[model samples]
Structure formats: structure tokens, C-alpha cells
Target: MEVAKILHMVGGVGETSYALNSTLQKKAMHIAKPIVQQSISQLYCKLQPTESLTIADLGCSCGPTTFITISEIMDEIYEVCHRLSCQVPELTFFLNDLPGNDFNSIFKYLPTYDKMVKKEKGSKYAPYYVVGVPGSFYGRLLPEESIHFVHSSYSLHWLSQVPRGLEDDSGAPVNRGNIYIDDTSPPAVIKSYVAQFKQDFSTFLSLRSKEIVSGGQMVITSLGRSDVDPLGGEVNCLYGLLAKALNSLVSEGVVDKEKVDAFDLPLYAPAIEEVKELVQNEGSFEFYQAKVFELNWDPFDDQMDDFVADSFVSGENAMKTIRAVMEPMLANHFGGAVMDALFSRYAMNVAEHLKKEKTKYVNFTVALTKRG
Candidate 1:
């Protein structure tokens, strides 16, 4: 599948839209806020008397979390400017995502966002301007040395495309019956995934190196694995369950098994060591800090004590979240007719899995500065 053409969150503000089902991503942003603040704080401290700043939020899908991130970064910059007794810099914000993303939804909400920023920061607040840039971050999306600070959250795990060569000499899917790397996947499948990640990450760092000025800071947070055991991570379980759901449909002859075999999700969860190694080899950025944290699969569990008892509620929310993000790609590949049945099965599987274990996603946050 051509990821750029097909990959986008379920659009609009309807029941199945990303805008309504993105609490998990919002919680992720909340957890990574401190790292973002620290990165922005250092950027301002290192470059005082800054007259203007340009910021980009990569893979900023349509949602409130996009503006929430902007507000948080601006808050830190405002504080830093106040301490330095300098006027807050005029700001240019870039909200970037795939071309198929719902830019219209985000644009519709911008007037409200501008009003909130003006009221909170005062009408005299340096003009804050936002523009939507549509493209993949795996390549250059901005002019050379245009950005001072860059931030991406809950993205980057998605590869630019599925790794090439997942088929045998006879042209059959090597990783048959699986949508992602799992325990049953062969070594060749694992090797293909790692190779793709290394190449893609190298390209990403290279592109960012040109777009960011020397000494500019970047903070990225994404799903990751904590150990070398690729199949042992919590994310693998989610995919495994999804595979089971698909296989169940295949068994009933409701969906074609060959189609399932041909499909592979373009996602890879790298370990922190892998990221460090790639950045070091790329040689354009120095790692400032890296951290790993776990978030419960159900982000709303904290607000409710009886999540386990209300398994249906938890299951529905989880299903909606996954559907909002994956439906576009899945529908494009598997046909739109299968989505309702597929997710219904997926929800039941998730609910059953929840009863057995409290799965938590491992998230990695890294801060880097361009080498001078």
C-alpha cells in the first residue's frame, strides 16, 4: 500500500472520527509534556534575544491535542521570554500530517484557537500564525534551516511503506496469517522490518538536519519496545489479537485469507538502543535525553475505578481508537465491507484480553539538538 496516499486518521468529528476517539493520543501528549517543555526551555535559553521562532508539529492529525501541544510549547517559551525580559517572539506554527488528513477540521477550529491564545497571552501577544503542510516527514517538508524547534508525538513508528520483499521465491507472503511481526513470524520477516526502520530513520534524521538550524532542538515520542525481544512488547499483543480477529473471519469464509496474507501494517516499534545507534550513525544530532514510560492501553482507566467490570465500555473505546487510526488503511486494503465485522470481532478479543492481562504500551521520548 502507498502509505502517503492511503494513510490518514478517520476524518471529521463524527462518532467514528479521530477527533472524538483520540483520548489515548491526548494522554500520550500529557505524559510527554514535560519533555517538550524542557526542550523548548533549553531552545530559548540557548538562543536568547530571539526575535522570531518557527515550530512544526509533525503528524499532527486533526484533534484538540494538536492545539494543546502548541499551547504547552508556547507557555514554556512565554515563561522563558519573561525571565529574559524580552518580548515573546513572533511565532510561525506548522501543523503537518498526511495529505489525506482532515485539514478542513483543523482550519475550522483555528479561529477559536487564535482567540484563546490572544485572551490568555494578551492581545499584544506576538502574532501567532499557523499553516497546514501536507506530506510525509520521511522527506523534507520545509525550507532549509527554517525551523527552530520540532515536535512529533505518537508518530514515527509508522514506516514510510511496508518493507520490501516479504514474499517467497514463489511470490507467496512469507509472513502469512500475520499482519505484523509476531512470535510465529520467521527471521526473514524480522530482518526485513529492521532494515526498513534503519533506512527510514536515517532518512528522517537527514531531512530534519537540513530543515532545522544548527542547535535547534527536536523532541519525539512514539510507541516503542523496551527490550530486544520484539515479540514481547505490549504492541505486539494488540496486533496479535487483530490477526486473530482477521483469521476468525477467514475461517468463517467471510473474508478472503489471501487478502490478509498480502496485507502488512507499516509499523515498527524500535527499542531505545536502536534509536540511539541510528542517531549516532547519522551524526547530525546529539542526543540530549531519552526516556521510556508505559501507558495503560485504556487511557481512561484512571478516571474510572471499575474499568474491568465495565469491559464493554473499555472494549468499545479501544476499538474506536484503533479504528479511527487504522480504518482508512485497512479499508483501502481489505475492502470497506469488512470493517464493521472486523472491528466488532476486534472489540470482543480486546475485552477478553483485558480480563487476562492489563496491557500497557511502552512509549519512548527522545530529545535531540542539531550539532553546530
Candidate 2:
């Protein structure tokens, strides 16, 4: 599958839209707000640009979370400038995502977003401007040495394409029953994923290195695992359950087993250290700090209890969240007809698993600066 052509969150502002089901991403961003604020403050103080500052939010999906990020960034800049007694610069924002992203839906809300920014900035700086740049962030998207600060939240885990080398010499799929890295995945399957991440991330950093001006900062928050072992994380169990849901349909002869065997998620959540080492290896950015945190799979379940208080409700919410992010890809591979039933089965499986153990998604955030 051509990931750039097909990968996008469910669009529109409907019940199943990513706009409504993106609380998990919003929560992750909120949890990493300190890092974001610090990065923005550092960039502002470091350059102290008086005329203009350009920012880019990579993988800016069509959701409220996207605007919230831009808003928070502008507010932080305003606060930092006021506190430091410096001139607040005119801000230019480049909102980037894959071509398939719902740029129209995002544009629809810009009028409101612009009004809010205008009121807050008052007469100090010119109005904040947003440019929707549709393209894969894995490559160059901005002019050379143009950006001041970059922010990407809850993205970058997705590989540019499905990992290569998933098949044996005889050409049989290596990971037959699983969709992502799991306990059952062989050594070759695991190696293939790591190789893919290394290549993609290095390319991303190299391209951005040419775009972001010297001393500019970048903050990346994406789905990740804290565990050293790739197979030993909450995300493994989550996708494993989805694979089981597909297998259930196969068992019932509702879908072909070959199709399930052929499908694998084009995503790999790296460990926090893995990201640091990759940046160091790429030789473009200085990795300052990295952190790992976890959130309940049901984003709405904020309590720290070790038990699922309402398995059914939690399962429904989890299903909706995953569906909003993944339905388009699943529909592309498995056909739109199977999506309703497949996710229904997935919900039941998640509910059953939650009854046994409450699982969460591990997240990683990194702060970096482009080397001069």
C-alpha cells in the first residue's frame, strides 16, 4: 500500500470523525506541554527575532487538537515575549500532513482560530497566519533555513511504508497471524521494523535539518514504548487484539485468511532511547531530553486504578478512538464492508481483555535543536 496516498485520520466533524475521537492525542499533547512551552521559550529567547518567526506543526491532522497546538504555541510565545521584555514577532505557521489529510475541514475552522489569535495578540504583532502544506513530512516541505520552531504531536510513529523483509526466502509472510510487533514475531520480523524506523526517521531529520534555521527547536511526541523488548508493551497487546478480531472473522469464514496474513500495520512505536540514538546517529540535531509516559487506552478513563471500572464503556471508547485513526487504512486493505463488523468484533475482544487487565498506550516525547 502507498501510505502517503492512503494514510489519514477519519475526516469530517461527525460522530466517528477524528475531530471527535482524538482526546488521546490531545491528552498526550497536554502531558507534554511543559516540553513544548520550554522549547518555544528557548527558541524565542535564543534568537530574539524581532521581525518574524516561522513555525511548523508536522502531521497536523484535521482535529481540534491541531488548532489547540497552534493556539498553545502562540500563547506561549506571547507570554514568553512579555515576560522577557522583548518584541513579539509576527508568526507564520506551516501546518503539514499527508495529501490525504482533511485540509478542507481544518480550513473551515481557521476563521474562528484566526479571530481568537487576533483578540489575544491585540495590537502587538500582525495576525498569525496558517498555511496548509499537504505532503508527507518524511521529506522536505519547507524552504531552507526558514523555520524557527517545529512541533509534532502524536505522529511520526507511522512508517513511510510497510516494512520490507516480512517474507521468507520462499516468499511466505513472516508475521502471519499478527499485525504488529508481538511476542510471536520472529527475529527477522523485529529487525525489519527497526531498520525501517531508522531509515525513515533519519531521512526526516536530515530533511528538516535543511529547513529549520540554526538554533531552532523541535519537539516530537509520538506513540512509543518504554520497554527494551519490542514485544513487551501495552501497544503490542492492543494491536494483537485487533489481529485476533480479524482472525475471528477468518474462523467464521466471513473473511479470507490470506488477506489477514497479507496485512500489517505500517507503524512502529520506538523506545525513547531508540529515538535519541537515531538523532545522534543522524548527526543533524542535538537531542536534549526524552521522556516516556502512559495513558489508559480509553482516554476518558483518567483514574489511575489498575482495573477497568466499566469494561464495556471503556471498550467502546477504545474502539472508537482506534477506528477514527485507522478506519481508512483498514477499509482500504480489508474493504469497507468488513469495517463495521471487524470493529464490532474488536470492541468485544477489547472488552473481554479489559475485564482481565487494563492496558494503556505508551508515549514518548523528545526535544531537539537543529545543529548549526
Candidate 3:
């Protein structure tokens, strides 16, 4: 699959769109806000007094949190300038995502966002400019040495493509009966995924190193695994459940089994060590902070839980969140006819699994500085 073409959050402001279904992502951004603020502040201290500052938010999908994140970063910079008695710099903001992302949804809110910044910052607000640049972050997307700070959240785990060599010499699927790397996947499948991550991440760092000025800072938060072993994390369980749902449909002849075998999600939740190794090997940035954190599987589950009743509701909510992000790619690959049924089965499987045990998503946040 061509990930650049197919990977995008569900568009529009309707019920199934990412705008409505992204509470989990919003929560993740809130959790990482403090780190983001600190990174900006520190980078500000290192920056020479200038009339303008350029910042980029990579993988900024359309949602309330997209503007929220930009606002928060601007606030941090304003605070730093206040303390130093420096004139607030003119702000140039680049909001980037895959080309297929819903830029219109994000653009619609810019007027309100600008007014909010002006209201909060008063006369001290910098002359702010925002532009949408659509492309993959795994390659160069900006002019050289232009960005002073970079921030990305709840992205970066998505690989550029499904890892190569998931087929045998005769071209049969090697990862049969599984849609992702699982405990049962062969060592070859595991190695292929890891190798892909290393290459993609290294390229990401290299391109950013060229685009960011020396001493600039980058903060990233993405779905990751706490376990050193790639196969032993909550992400594996999540995809495993998805695979089960697909298998059930295959059994009932509602979906083609061979189609399932040919499909693999273009995602990999890297271990912290693997991330650290890539940063070190790439030799362009200093890793200032790297930590793993946990979030509940169902971030929206606030009500009282009757194991039987709430499980279904919680499962449905979880499925919606996944659907908002994954549905586009799935529908393109698996055909739209089966999606409603596929997710229905997925919801039940998740509901049943949650009844037995609580599940959490492991997340990793890292802060880096471009080397001189």
C-alpha cells in the first residue's frame, strides 16, 4: 500500500470524523503539553534575539487539538520572551500532514485561532502566519535551516510502508493469519518490521537535521511499547484483537481470507531502546528526554462500569477512535462493504477482552536538540 496516499485521519466534523473521535489523541497531547512547553522554553533561551521565529508541527492532523497545540506553543514562546524582556518574535507556523489529510477542516478554524492568540497575548502577540504544507516527514519538506522548533504527537509510529519480505520465495504471505507483528509471527517478520523502522526513523532525523537550525529543539510523542521485546506490548494485543476480528469474518465468508493475508498495517510501535539507538546512530541530535508512559485503552471511559454493560460501550468508543484513524486505509485495501461489519465484530472482541482485564496503551515521549 502507498501509505502517503491512503494514510489520513477521517475527515470533516461529522460523527465518524477525527474531529469527533479524537478524544484519545487529545488526551495524549494534553499529557505531553508540559514537555512541549519546556522544550520550547529551553530552545528559546538558546536562540539569539531575532525579529521572527519559525516553528513546525509535524503530523498535525485536523482536530481541535491541532490548533490547541499551536496555541500552547505560542504561549510558551510569549512567556519566555516576557522573562527575557525580548520583543516577541513574528511567528511563522507550518502545520504538516500527509497530502491526503483534511486541510480544509484545519483551515476553517484559523480565524478563531488567530483571535484567541490575540486575545490571550494582547499587544505582545507576535504577528503570526500559518500555512499548511502537505507531505511525509520521512523526507525533506521544508527549506534548509528554517525551523527553530518542531513538535509532533500521536504520530511517527506509522511506518512509510509495510515492511518488505513478508512473502516466501513462491510469493505466499509469510505472516499468514496475522495482520501485524504478533507473538506468533516468525522471527523474519519481526526483523523486517524493525529494519523498516530504523531506516524510516533515520531518514526522518536526517531530514529534520537539515531543516532545523543548530541548537533547535524537537519534541515527539507517539504510541510506543514499554517492553524491550517488540512482540510483547499492548500494541500487539490491540492489533491481535483486530486480526481476530478479521479472521472471524473470513470464517463466515464475509471477507476474503487471502485478502487478509496480503494486508499488513503500516505501523510499528518501537521500543525506547530502539528509538535511542536510532537517534545515536543518526548522529545529528542529542536525546534530552526519552520516557515511556501508559494511558488507558479507553480514554473516554469515565462513567461507572458494569463489567457487562460498560464493556460494550467502552469497546465501541475504542473502536470509533481506531476507526477515525484506520478506516481510510482499511477501506481502501479491504473494500468498504466489509468495514461496518468488520468493526462490529472488532467491537465485540474488544468488549469481551476488556471484561477479563484492563488494557493500556504504552506511549513514548522524546525531546531532542540539533547538534552544532
Candidate 4:
């Protein structure tokens, strides 16, 4: 099914889609700092030709965050070049993501980058060019062995498509009363999502490995869990929240209670161990670093509170908003009945929770390098 159709069926993009790029800025450059530093270090230590250097930001959404990431990466590269008394390479950076992504917004910000680069060298200067590439990162998006450094944030955890059985008879099994379970919900569910992630990630690694220079490095950050168990509690908690939200809609008559009760969520957030397994199984890369940190929302407490308020002040309003937000996600993940109650409950809970505390989570970032 088309991405649009999937989204429409599930409901619509909800608070999750709210200014996504802007929110990501809260995550630091430190997690991926080593890879950026290493790539530059390799260029200098190996006396690699600067003319061949290239960097890419996969899933580069349009916003100040993208620019910030690019700036930090370039600075890291420049530091290495400076230490070696070498002129910076002719840099060609690729900004890539889904075809529907906002290319215009990204390009609009490009000219400013040119101006900013000049400020770096003062009287000195370096040549850097950036272009936007539109495509799914699941397949080969670049020429073989053409890139030197790559980075992706909050993208890999997304399955290319929702697994087939997600909306099938097993839907309720994936939902534990008040909450929803993730791809790792049950042994069976875990198998389903793991199989999908394995396939998607394998393709991702194979394609990226071919494009990345032998010594090139990459850092990818995703919504990750702390355990490998398909039935882990954290997984259940998140699903439960979403399910609870959906239940609120059902009660309001915006969605048929029966329909809301039947749906199931198709996405999964893997544990650090699972991610490490993916890297090792691909067998082309060496692990350099792995770090997990809690994604905090204390700073955005106000914004989150407002989002909760606007979304679920009443049954009808909440259902309307949820239907719109969930349609696309449902279609993408494959629709099912298990998630209805789970999502409804999530909406109601958010409304209630905002009356008190804030929302927060723990996430992970992993960095790797192909064997030189």
C-alpha cells in the first residue's frame, strides 16, 4: 500500500509528527562524536586524499537540527585537518531521506551554510557542496564505496513496512489489557518484528557498507530498549500508553469501540544488544562504541503539556485527532484490532498525566566502522 493510504487507514499523524526535526535537537552530538572524529583522524593519519572525502546525513529532515548536525560534523573534520596541517578536502555532503520529505526546506537553508563555512576559515577558506537526495534508505542510494562518513538519527527503528500479521488474529495477544506490546511483545510478535528488522537492517548494512570507504565510520541513533525480551515491560508500557489513548477515542464514539479494540501497533524499538547483534551478523563492521541515554522532556514540559491538552480535552476531540494521527501509521504498520483500546487508553492517560507529571524516555545510540 502507498504511504498515504497506510497513514489514512491508521488515522493520521499524531503528536509524534509534531515538528519532529526540532525536537531531535535535544539529543547531543556527543554520541556520534567519536565517529566524526575518527573519520577525520583516518583522513590525516592515513594521509588519505582530501579530494575523495564525502559525508552523508541519512534521514536528514528539514530544520535547524539538520544544519546543526552538519555543522558539528564539519567542525570535527576540520579539527583533524588542522592538526595535520592539511587543507580541508573538497566536501560533498549528501542530505537524504524519503522522497516525500521536505527537500525545499532543506535547500532553502543551504545558502546559509555556504555563508557559515566562510566564517570558519577567517582569511582562509575551504570548498564544500551539499545536495539533497530523495529515496528510501532501505536500498542502495549511493554509488558503491563512494562515501567516507555517514550518520542517521531516529530512523532505523522504523520498519520499512508494518509486518503482515500485525493486524491479524494475534492483535489482542499483542495488547495486554491496558497497554500495547511492541514487535517484541510476545515470542511470536518478537519473531515477526525481529524478522522484519533483520531484513531491513541487513539490507541497510549491505548497501551502506558498499558505499562507505573501508575505513569510513557511521553513527546511527534509534529509539532503543534496554532488553532483548519480546515481552519486556518497557515495551508494554509504551504500547499501553498508545492503547490507552485509542480507547479514549472509542469511548467518544469517534471510532467504533470494537474497531478501536481490534487494532495493534506495528513498530518496535530494539535493545542495544539486539542492535549489536545486527552489526555483528552483517559481519562487515567492527563495533567502536555503544551508549544509551534517557531522552528527557523536562525542558519541553510546557510544549508536551500543550500537545496533550490540545489532543484530548474531550472524547470527541481526542478521537478526531487520534483518528487523523493514527491512520497513516496504521496503514504503514498494517491495521489490526488489538491497538484500538491501547491507543484510546493512551489518549486518556496523556490528558490525565499532563494534569500532573511530564513524559520522558530512555534511548540509545550506536557507532560502528567497517574493518579497515
Clashes per model (N, Cα, C within 3 A) = 0, 0, 0, 49
Kindly list the per-residue Cα lDDT of model 4 for residues 171-244, writing each as its tens digit.
44343323235443455555776788788888888889999988777888777776677566344554555665
Superposition error at 57 for model 3 (Å) = 0.9
Report the C-alpha displacement of residue 226, candidate 4, in angstroms. Answer: 1.3
lDDT (CA) per prediction: 0.89, 0.90, 0.89, 0.62
Error of 2 at 269 (Å): 0.8
Q: Which residue pairs show backbone clashes in model 3?
A: none
263-304, model 3: which lDDT tens digit per residue? 998999998898999999999999988767777677686432
Off by over 4 Å in 3: 302-309
Show model 2 residue runs off by greater than 4 Å.
none
Model 4, runs deviating above 4 Å: 1-21, 28-31, 38-40, 167-187, 233-236, 257-266, 298-348, 351-360
RMSD to the hidden true structure, all candidates: 1.7, 1.3, 1.9, 6.1
CA displacement after TM-score superposition, residue 214 of candidate 2 (Å): 0.9
**What TM-score against the true fold does each predicted structure earn?**
0.97, 0.97, 0.96, 0.77
lDDT of 1 by residue, 10-59 (tens): 99999889999889899888888899999999888888787889999999
